[model samples]
Target: MQKTLSTLTNNWAPSSLSQKVFLAQQVREHEAAAAQPCGFSMYMLMQRAGRGVFGHLKATYPYAHNILVLVGVGNNAGDGYVVATLAKSFGWQVTVAALNPHKVLSGDADTAQQAWIAEGGTIRPWQDIDFKNFDVIVDGILGTGLKGQVRKDASELICALNKTDLPVLSIDVPSGLDSDTGVPLGICVHADCTVTLVAKKQGMHTGQGKTYTGKLIYDDLDIALTFNKIAQPSAYLVSYDQLPKLEKRQANAHKGNFGRLLTLGANAGMPGSLRLTSEAALRTGAALVRAYCHTDSRLSISIGRPELMLTSDGLSAQLAWSTCLAIGPGLGTDKWATKLFNETMAHIESEQKTCVIDADGLNLLAESQHAFSTIFSPKHCVITPHPGEAARLLGCDVPDIEQDRLKAAQSLAKHYNAVCVLKGAGSIISNGEQSWICTDGNPGMATAGMGDTLTGIIAALLAQGMSATDAALYGVCLHGAAADIIAQQYGQRGMLASDLFEPLRVLVNPT
Candidate 1:
């Protein structure tokens, strides 16, 4: 009997829902364990993978009458052959295009290829066919085993596949893409959708992998629950939905019930960033949000936001009253900015107060590693840096940081001895030991003042009794979730950083 969709949903739900990400090598080890003495055969596993891919493809593209299956030299090809056989059985025109005519298949892959041949399926050399004739192309060229750039012939074919504008369904990790790092080697297949077998590859959700592996689909092939116990996840993919709701406030509680948060930024011409930060803290439920800007900026900043207790002279008093501090939203690297940055560092290091450092504050840190190491303590600090800021802090190129975001975030956290929030497409939140990726937020959040807003949000969460790590993770998720909601209403284009304020308030309180 053909399995119902319920079987797939029931058996496969936890694979994606679970908070675990296995590296490529870890996935190989898990698969090896699954094929052991008491477990299923590699052939059986391949059969399930092939069937799963075929089922998803058939359902997704019901009108697609012609399928061009790109087969390589490995078990990935074995899966493709099985797909062709199934498609032919369903009376659809199927063509298996061989990318590696010289390679000899072995083990379960050899068995799978023979089954297709026995069923009257003819395999054609890649050079013999034209891609324009097919309705949809199936990419099974390279599996997770690929480490480097694709070979010459495959690169040519991949380039061709990409140019056709046809909907390509990748069987596993897209050809030439690092299944571990998410960096595309030399050239990679840009698939419309990728059906990841076994478990979701760690690379598929991060870095450049997000662009190549569109519409990621995971099929665990009915592995027993014990399969998950084989490896501890390298990291968890987190979202706002998974976080705990904040406790309801007491009716009689006053302003001091929630903690006080102080923001230090807004040099001469840069008042807007700090203003956004202070307001965001208030919007996120800080009992009192204060801003200490340059004496010159106080009048302009105080005009619109009277709720913020803007002060310049009593820096010591404000620092003492504040439970949490957020520095660097608009703090430039000028003389005045440097003095304040130095003072904030001294106070936080001495008191071990929770703090979030972002924007130009990060720049000041990158300017002198010697000065930074001398002044700061990671005990209660959270550093938020975009790729450019991270590159500066690490003394590396932006591409180098982007190529391996997880590593960069972890390295940053360890280097600063604090929680690191590496903000980008898939923001990585790490404290050296453990990490989480916040897969929320939209391209609309690419506006100015967004980072400032995030600084305030995280600082507010910290002021409200969250640990540095929890506040970073929860704040990143909430910030992104709020932006996502605002994007839906305002559209991604022309969306402002301030649009997140109301939605953020609703998210924190959750009425």
Candidate 2:
């Protein structure tokens, strides 16, 4: 269950029927494996699925006076018939683009089709109708059963669909898009909103799926089925606007009220890394921040920023005071870095200090595999690893992790019993038992030291008493929001991580 967040639906997004069927199979598999049976019947499940999808559409396009639903020969067409009939019964102008050329539909699909016709529904094909005349198109053609490239007729239909600027509400995933992959089957509908039933499909998160499935949304469809073997989710998306607000501060609050942030790294020429983290923490409202850097960088760091109590290769002065530690930004992974990382990890673990590890620190962990467990316990740690670092942690290649970020993030979190933020576009955040995908941040954040900024931001929020879950949500959002502001000032290409500090300050406490 989500942590104190509102339901997944904020602005509703509907999905395709293929996705619904996939969820059914998933539920069935869960029942077969988990020993708990879903109390609902299959037909009842289908009914809920149809109604839930319809409900979202009605809510989304409430202003549309006329709704045109395109129905095919499959069960998806049956769903369309259901919606169209409902709309017509409610006295709206409804038309059906019946692509079922032959008079041959079966099962529940045929039953629904006949009922629509009996109630005076009109039908036509692409050749016979001007699709643009409709305000909205309900695509129920060719559901998830479609595996190969779309046929000529379907492609023509899809092309016709593309020609119209009219918004489309797809039932059970978009037509011509693979429910599991989102790649167009040589043709696909560009839906404005997709209504998905039961559970979401894997294809919605990665690759081209995000484009086809505009605004990924979910609906349980009132199918109260017990599931045992929940397929590992493929990816995650951070829900928006449901983030927790900071606790109210008392007028008597002092420096001690905010947590202390400890940052390690900044080897010589790379003072930029340590500075970014320290600056970010302070700017993001950390009460106190201290940076431990190379002797060569100490003078420069101190000169550039008087706020930081910079020390050369000495963390003992700050370690005892820090509530959360951020390590590895600009920390080279050479002999010097290895020694520093090992020493810090050991001290943090032995002293029971809460910590975050990132950049070369993760690389160091990979280098000294056994040292990780020795230095940090599961609960007091968070690791921000990009694909390469994640691969190193798992002893695999980056491609394997990218193939499934959700699994990769989970594995890293579970193995260490630590919060793992898999850095990159659509970042995966997990604490082994639970996980999330960041829905914010743009390409401007691809610049250097961004990860370091995130490390400090997370540390700062944690020090501020946000639980790991809320801390992550707040940190990621704040980090992205800061980056966005910088991007606005310097353009995405010129926005550096350091540029984020001031923006972070504004976002943390605008008042």
Candidate 3:
């Protein structure tokens, strides 16, 4: 007997099952080979996928009697057909709408369609249907096989669907969404819930996919363990649960036992940026945090944070005292900023100290004349860059970086020979060889000073004896997770970067 997805964690996948993300091609190429090992045929897998979608729909919207299943002519359409059949069996009013009623569907998709017909169901043209009558919409149109922009007709249909208030449940990958890059081919179905089958598509968790795929549910159809064994994941999805646990301090441990972190930045008028970075380092367990800023901003930075040791002199001595360094924040592109950034980079390279460079530091690095490989040690450095800064660093347009963020992040890491945290909707951390995407965080974090906070967190972790890769991974997840908590409590709107400090302190000491 095939175990239904309902019996396995209420139609939702366990973290272990959903952690590994694969490209659309990997899933298409290896799904059959993976299924064979479990003695399941392609049709059997299709049937299970349909069953999973139906089970979840029923559970989520029990009162939804009238459903419209929007389908294209592919395996995704087959899944929709299965859902229609199952809904019909359960005495619900199910309507399966096909983009082209005359187009032929071969193989298992055809088999599934025939099965739906056998169940006395009719396939209606999407144009003729009244969407307002349906309680929920099942999107199965143009799954992972979508190659380019959606055709004019399909685009119209997707746009029409988006305009409706009906609750949408997308099958496999969301229709018209690129399952690999998370970019929409043209316009994608804005699903309220996406029940992904086989393996989680890398796209659904990041980029524009996050907006389109609302509440993501993964159902492996009982073959994910087998599928994962066969396919090499392009990247891994990271969350709060996967954070590296900080070791408990010994009873005798003092301030000096943790680490010394020096945060350098805050040009003439940007005291808040430096303050946020230094405070974040303090919250993340850095023993002693020093703020080395310009004399113009010293009073404002030092007055509020009495815990911070503020200094305007002794750059060489501060660099020597610090176990880890976080530079950039408010460091501008002026002569003052340039001199500090150069001295800091030189010190990091010569002293072999771990450092995190963000904001103006990244800008300076991008504008640097020396080869990146020679000036920085890859193992001891981390760079945090938003899409614009990343574009500058890579000498490409923002669209190029956003088009394929995973590739861009890896490129940044490889190019700079350092761990790169590509900050955006889905923050990606990469060390060139391995990559992880943070699934936490919300729109509230889009405010100013967030990047500075991240730099501080990463530097603190590095100071606390974590490797550059581990620090980047842990810091990115931690920063986002903290913002998620803040967003939940105070709402996403009007949230501040300084708001994260309290939660950062709480989360870093996770019990």
Candidate 4:
């Protein structure tokens, strides 16, 4: 039997709703086919979309009586018309401002437009309207089909709407924003709230998308299950709920059972980075953490952390003793740092041990001429690189890396044959076959030593027997969630990297 929309949604799991993310093309191409399984046509889907937006707006702004619906020549305009018709029916003062007042819409869009006109709704050119007179603006100027830069007329209309202080509600997607990459095509509508239909787009949850898409509300329209069955998601959006839980310790479990992590770095003048990494590893439940640094760094790195086994000699012995390795926190590119890095890489490759390479280690690897496969195996290696380091490793510019972070992370993982955590606003974790975006961090985590702390956390998870991909996924989400907790309490400014330790510990041992 064909299930009803309410029946499907009632059984939908919250975790699945929040976590699955798809590409713009996937949704555009598959939505109609997906709707069919639920006995809905494209026009029926459009009607539901319009109804959802209007219902949400009514609930959100109970007193908002006057509204301006700005629309362009596309299916998006059809959605706007539907909203306008619904508003007029409800006795609210509504105006439909068309970017092209004379242009005709077709198919499902045409049906929606005709219905609005039949209901005695009028359409005016967008330029003729005074935006200040309206209580709210409904943005239906463009949809997910947006290609390249926005045209001048549409761009000017979007700019005018943005200039207004009145709240704006966007349907499908904020016009001018790339639904796939989350980047703006020149200028995008800065909506106060966006009601995205169908499945969640990857772009909406990351990068500049977050800035443009204010409070996001998803209406699957009861077809997400059918859509998901037809298409695989580009990436999963991970949060605290999706993190891998650590197994409870046995009463007889000893320190050795938890695993040891060896963290290398802190050459001469840069002791704090090493300290942050080593301490983070400890806080993340590494049974024992050993810090191998330059002789001058030993005292400073171990000053407050007596539990850390510090050493300046016997690199081979330290590497042998630890279950996993985290390299590159304060590791410089000088000859001494290079020698240690090379030796460690050689040891890791030869022993086939699990490892994390971050910061300077990534920088050094970028400089190395050796093939990535010769140095690291995908099964046991994870690389965490911010945009700058990722650009260096990928031989590209920072803008190029940020252009499509998902692609950049996947490229790094494929090129290096290891799990890649491309760190930034939606830190991406990709292992070629699967990808995830960490949606928990804040801008406050931009401070120094943050990457170092992340390196330690991932290393600890790896040492404790998580797979390379699982460790990176869990570590990145945990790192960001911890930062969010701190930002809520202390605010983002002046938030130190070390501030995450308490929350990190608390989060990893989730109740």
Candidate 5:
């Protein structure tokens, strides 16, 4: 059951997430400052921002006969005023549909509003109009300043807009997407394309942000600002440039120089599972990869990849010689599997060894807190669990894991006193302190044996001297990075775990 949850990763992926990070507001601020005028007046910047948005609209909806701008009572609404005025000048029927008619708008927004009205553009209350009648809807209903869930008038309008099927051009993120977590704060606007201004917002890429952003466009309003004053982002969406490069091995090195890897899993029909794990380990550059799984499983295991060694069970003393042990690829929940699981746990408890536990191994551990409560140091342990397995380990639900992935991973690391890899579409690795999100991987790699591949990658990293936490982060980052290459070669829908081996092999050769 724990292993089945690993496959759920297939549906949880977001497309090209790193590009979403470029939508951050911080970058938007930098762009504005580039075209700063002498005095740097706020109104002047707003004017440029309005013009920039109008420019994009012209290019996006050039054939539109009518353009309807939804306005609020803030700076976001002011941008709408600018868009309406620009479109009106081109003979496009423009309307400023004010969501909050009674609220007085001020600052640059107020000025922009009066100018649009003076120029013969009609400003009408939103209550008087239906969204379905609009040719194009410019959503200026919310801004980055919004916090908490949206409700009431704004929520109703967002709902109405979604039903219109109009090509919406959003300004600075889809209204309800969180600037940090990428989760929606209640109801959110669905945009056909979002033209974010000034700085990029974090929410546009991670979590559920991609769906809301649509065809995202960037607009830097040319304002003067200092990045030093703005705090650095707490997290990052991994990109190709951010991935660690793999180096070619030195000519003098041999198979022994890489590091020996030992694994235990595979029972009967599940040999494909352990076989996949071993192959990933070997392909990932493990010096000498070996496995202890069901003997009958060897029919397919040694067919092509003769490098793998098979056995029914492992010698108790063999733990001393192995650099890292990967456990639970397909260790089915049978009586013998339990005995093997206990024996593996015994080795981990008595010796200072590096090991990764997945699948049934995790289930067995969840059966009794006493098994996890053993007095072994947490430094050598890495626990990789999908949502359900994680839920069982933490005594919670799947929603709890998705609600705050950082919190769940960190909490698990702190409780278990080991690195926890919360396996999912934005796989998180944490040691109760420094945590990282792996931006690599695509929907194609979501097929069977994917998590096993990850287990092998991390174990290989550990065998080569990466600490439990570093190995976990590096492994996660590298695994996803490799999957990204596969995704690019084969379309996202058809990418496979085996396709990642070549990229993984290249990434870890040296550097």
Candidate 6:
């Protein structure tokens, strides 16, 4: 089964996720700062946090009679203790597994442990219990403080937990997860759901974070508003709701009222990629859509999709006539591709026309980095690159790119002087100074031709008179939203790029 968190209800999503995402350290520092102003002690905050977890557990897993709580040395264990204590009072079977020796617990965690004991709750060593006895596992072993590889014993326990099919609810951040990077240190708990406190950690929404953190539920512990005031967010998560709708057209509007766009690709043998892109532009309501392809591929492209105005002659002329240019779909990195890439760059530089770059087009640009420095401008260009392409553009490995996707995207924007779209789980749209994270897309979108389709959407939006920033922002959201609609209908297993075309039409013309 695909590892995805099903959006069960509107309640599954946090009502206030639009606020900036804080890093693991930021949440810790800010929570303390925010709590001190109200004279709230760590112990008091722990009580509120534990109560929050207990409330959510009762609401979500009402039928669960046996709960296995994993306790650590940190205050995260305190939250687990509170949950166990409450569960015992509710007359449910509760077992506390102490992954860390209970004697090491101090401060608020010690107080929490004493409270659990006061309620007749006994702690068991990690190895002493059989996991099958429990219906649910409460992971509170590690929080955001984890770094490096997980210890051997904890790693074994995590692996053992993964072997079982029981639903695991993680407290704070999952144990063995790098709350800053969303990457597992060496081993990480694969949670069925994660209850984050204070604010959502920025890492939990990107990279491997999504796979590890299932249905993400946030509890501010009632300190979010005050905490957010003192701790500036690392980045803001953006949604389509925050975007402005496209202005309606007049009754007398014609093709010219929208925008004309020229798509350059379909070099030799590759007609499908350019066709998907050109048709996507048409679907997005671009008035006049044209495709410039190799002489060999031109006939198939024309016969396959007559809606596009196909041309082999006047490459520079087409670039000048069109209001926006989308290049790189099926664009191979050969001498012929180089000629076209250079010519398109020259035209955009001279005319200052808006442009979108994707696929092998990014590869060609990566090859001539120094030459592009003089020509590329952020005001008119947007480059979409998946992780592999982004690595090439940034001259780093894919892991380096994934290690910090937000930074990679922002770096690409700054380095290329263009709006950069580092496409992945939470596609980051950046123009260096400002950034927005799109959280709409699903894992099924990991298909071929997806990037090509995105290029067409962004270019079409730009042609329709949106600013480069707005075009990039709206285009990414629209593309993802359309994909989501298709995933829902077709079950995402055999989803094709064309599945998004009809949905794109309906979404872009939002009434």
Model 4 regions more than 4 Å off: 1-18
lDDT of each: 0.83, 0.72, 0.87, 0.87, 0.73, 0.83
Native-vs-model 6 lDDT? 0.83
lDDT of 6 by residue, 1-511 (tens): 2111111111112235345687888877778878877777878888888888888887778889899999888888888998899888988899999886646677888899999999988888988989988889999888888767998878988998888889999998888888777888999999988998988787788878889999888898877667867876667776665565666666677787667899999889998899888988888878799999988898888886667899888887888788889999988988889999999988888888889999989999888845665577777889999999999998989999988888888899998899898899889888887777788888888898888888888888777776677788878988888888988988777778888999898887759
| Model 4 lDDT per residue over 159-269, tens place | 998999999999989999998888889999998899999999998887778889988899898887788778778888887655545566556766787677899999999
- Candidate 1 ranges beyond 4 A from true positions: 1-17, 35-39, 369-379
Could you give candidate 2's per-residue lDDT for residues 358-473 as a string of tens digits? 88888888777574555555556888899899999889998778656667888888776677888876676777765665666777887788888898888887676655655666
- Which ten contiguous residues of candidate 3 have the minimum total lDDT? 2-11
Q: What is the C-alpha local distance difference test score of candidate 5?
A: 0.73
Give me the displacement of residue 508 in model 1, in angstroms: 1.1
Top candidate, metric TM-score: 3
What lDDT score is found at residue 380 in candidate 3? 81
| Candidates 2 and 6 compared by lDDT, better number | 6
Off by over 4 Å in 2: 1-74, 84-105, 117-137, 142-167, 175-190, 198-209, 217-244, 249-253, 256-259, 295-304, 315-323, 424-426, 438-449, 464-470, 480-511
Q: What's the TM-score of every candidate structure?
A: 0.93, 0.71, 0.95, 0.94, 0.81, 0.94
- Candidate 6 residues lying further than 4 Å off, grouped into runs, are 1-18, 36-39, 369-371
Model 5, 1-511: lDDT tens per residue?
1110011121122233232343245554554344444455667767777788888888898878687799888888888888888888878888788888778888889998988989987778887887777788999888776768886889888888888878999877677766665677898887899887765565564446666788767664543234322324434455334544444555576776766778888887788777777888787767688888777787867788877876665457556667678888898888878878787777777776788888877787777556464534456789999878888888989877766666687788888778899887677676766556666666566688889888998888777666686567667777887888877776778666777889887776554
Candidate 6 — worst ten consecutive residues by lDDT sum?
Answer: 3-12
